[model samples]
Target: MRHYFNDLPKTALTAGYWLFVAYLLLPLTLMMSMSFKDANFIAFPIQDWTLRWYAEVLQDRQFLDAIAYSAFIAFATTVCATVIGVWIALVVATEGIFGRAAIFALACLPAVVPGLINAISMRIFIRVIDLPTGTAAIILAHTVHAVPFVVIMALTRLRSMPKNLTDAARDLGADPFIAFVRVTIPYLMPALLGGMIFCVLTSIDDFVRTFFLGGYKPTLPMLIFAKVQGGMSPQINAMATIVLIATALIGLYAEYLTRRARK
Candidate 1:
């Protein structure tokens, strides 16, 4: 009796963990399952399971265009965000140009601010500047949202980097730029890679901000939203499932690299 009572917390925790996972994954499972169902409309007790929906999605020109556009934006955002973030991290970690807290706060402000607010602000700013909205506008907005993630990751990694490596490079008569490229960047690469992954994911998944900032071009998420409003189709489910699988693969690869780096 005493053992049972003592084990109650463990039992509860185990049950809670499974329950939480179910809460998170059940919907995804349903979506994936539905995607395979041979039906024109989304329905449970799925009948005639087939890969027809996947085939349909693959042949969709508009969907393909959206995917390509989103990928381009995500790639651009990752590059710009990674560079800007590394610069901010370097400044905060090495130079005392601005107080660390102040710099960090400003860098992370986009994360704290609501997405809608960021979207509205960017829209207004672009309008004020008479900048035509399109891929460029979307890229800039995504970069703004993504930079904070890179800054946080890069800063954490930079804080732990051995200052002696950089100093040693300088001591060996290496110029600052060369020293940074040779000594510092290698050390920062793992964190920078993680930040790149995060930034890509953020840009790919973003909808609210992209909707406002993207002028004529539609991203994957925007495409999904439009299709969903027209009513759920198996093709949409297939596209979503494909995206989910891609995201999971990327996340797993990032995790593997991070663990490998630690070793």
Candidate 2:
């Protein structure tokens, strides 16, 4: 009877875990299913499935352009965010730095700020600085939004790192810069790579900030949003499914790389 009671909790947890997985995956499954629908419009009963939507989406010039543009912005944002984040993490990790806690908090604040608010504030800030709304502005906004995540990841890795690694390098007649480049950077690679992946994902998915700062050229999210305004269709679903699959692949690849780095 006691074993049955103990097993009851385990069974419940197992059930709950599957249920949570279903909750997360069911919607995505439905969305993917819809992309294969034969009809132009979105509907259930997907009795007639076709690859026409996917075929058309692949041939779309606008879609291709948006994908390329978003990829560019994501790359730029990742580079900027990664550099700034690593710098901030180093500063916070250093001893005898003034207001280290405050600096860390401020660096991470943009992450917690509401997206709409951040977008609006960034719009105002750009205008105040006379920075025209375009690719530069969009990259700037994404960099700001992405920096905090990089900081947190890099900082966590930094804190867990042993001091002896760098000390050993220093004792071997290596200067601070050399030690940092050789020892510190290699140790921080997994974290930096993970952060860069996250930055890419977030920047690509960002719509609000991009919408506000975008000029004539449209990003992938912006293009998706514009299509959604027209109405939902299997084509749109196909586009979304393509993006979802691409991002998922990127995330999985990052996980593989991080695990490999640890080993």
Candidate 3:
């Protein structure tokens, strides 16, 4: 016998969802409020609401520098990761590649493995290889981490792609490169764009891996972590709020563009 629809729980589900949403967003909401507080101590229910902290972040040299550094690294990671990931995906999609499964597993190991362990291992490996721990090193590390995500996204699109499209293009006198550029790329653009955005954000917000790999340069997240450890400040809260808002905006824009492309 089927249970009656009236027997189903409703309020419990709503309560649980609300609790989960609060868990995900309460800290962010608190941070947003703290950013506007006019005092050093981070008290809930801000006494004064001011944009002073936001202005301070704008004027602070260290904050500006960190933002620039993070931006550079994120952009670099997105580009390198996208290029390598797409190329690897193309190789994976092609027939008769030796040890294709092995290659896929190797490429995605960074994504599935514990990042802290990976960081330590990467640090050891880089030192052995005589690679300097600087921006270049961070870029390399970020790219390696970013590539797996890129591959997963690109491969999903590539596998479902029809072979007849490429064949038809070839029959119409288009070269392999042209066919891929004109057809495959346009079709794969959404997943590729989404992956690139994810890569950039990951590289930007990353502190643990960047902490171990970075020589001296403090990326924005690293600096924020340091400030957070010292004490709570309106400035830190303000900066965090700004970053969170920026990330949200980017995600929304990317989603809009990708959805539009699909339509």
Among the numbered candidates, top TM-score falls to 1
Taking all chains together, the TM-score of candidate 2 against the true structure is 0.95
What digit string (tens of lDDT, one per residue) describes model 3 on residues 7-114?
Answer: 557656777899999999999888898888888888766677789989999999999999999999999999999999999998888899998888888999888778
lDDT per residue for candidate 1 within 1-263, as digits (tens), equals: 78767899888889899999999999999999999999787777876889998988999999999999999999999999998998888888866575887887898999889999999999999999988888888899989888889999988888888889988999999999999999888888888888999999999999999999887778999999999999888888899999999999999999889888878
- Candidate 1 deviant stretches above 4 angstroms: 1-5
In candidate 3, how many Å is residue 81 off?
0.7
List the pairs of residues colliding in candidate 1.
none
In Å, residue 127's CA in model 3 sits off its true spot by: 1.2
RMSD of each: 1.5, 1.7, 2.6
Q: What number of backbone clashes does candidate 2 have, counting pairs of residues 3 or more apart or in separate chains?
A: 0
lDDT of 1: 0.90
Q: Each model's TM-score?
A: 0.96, 0.95, 0.95
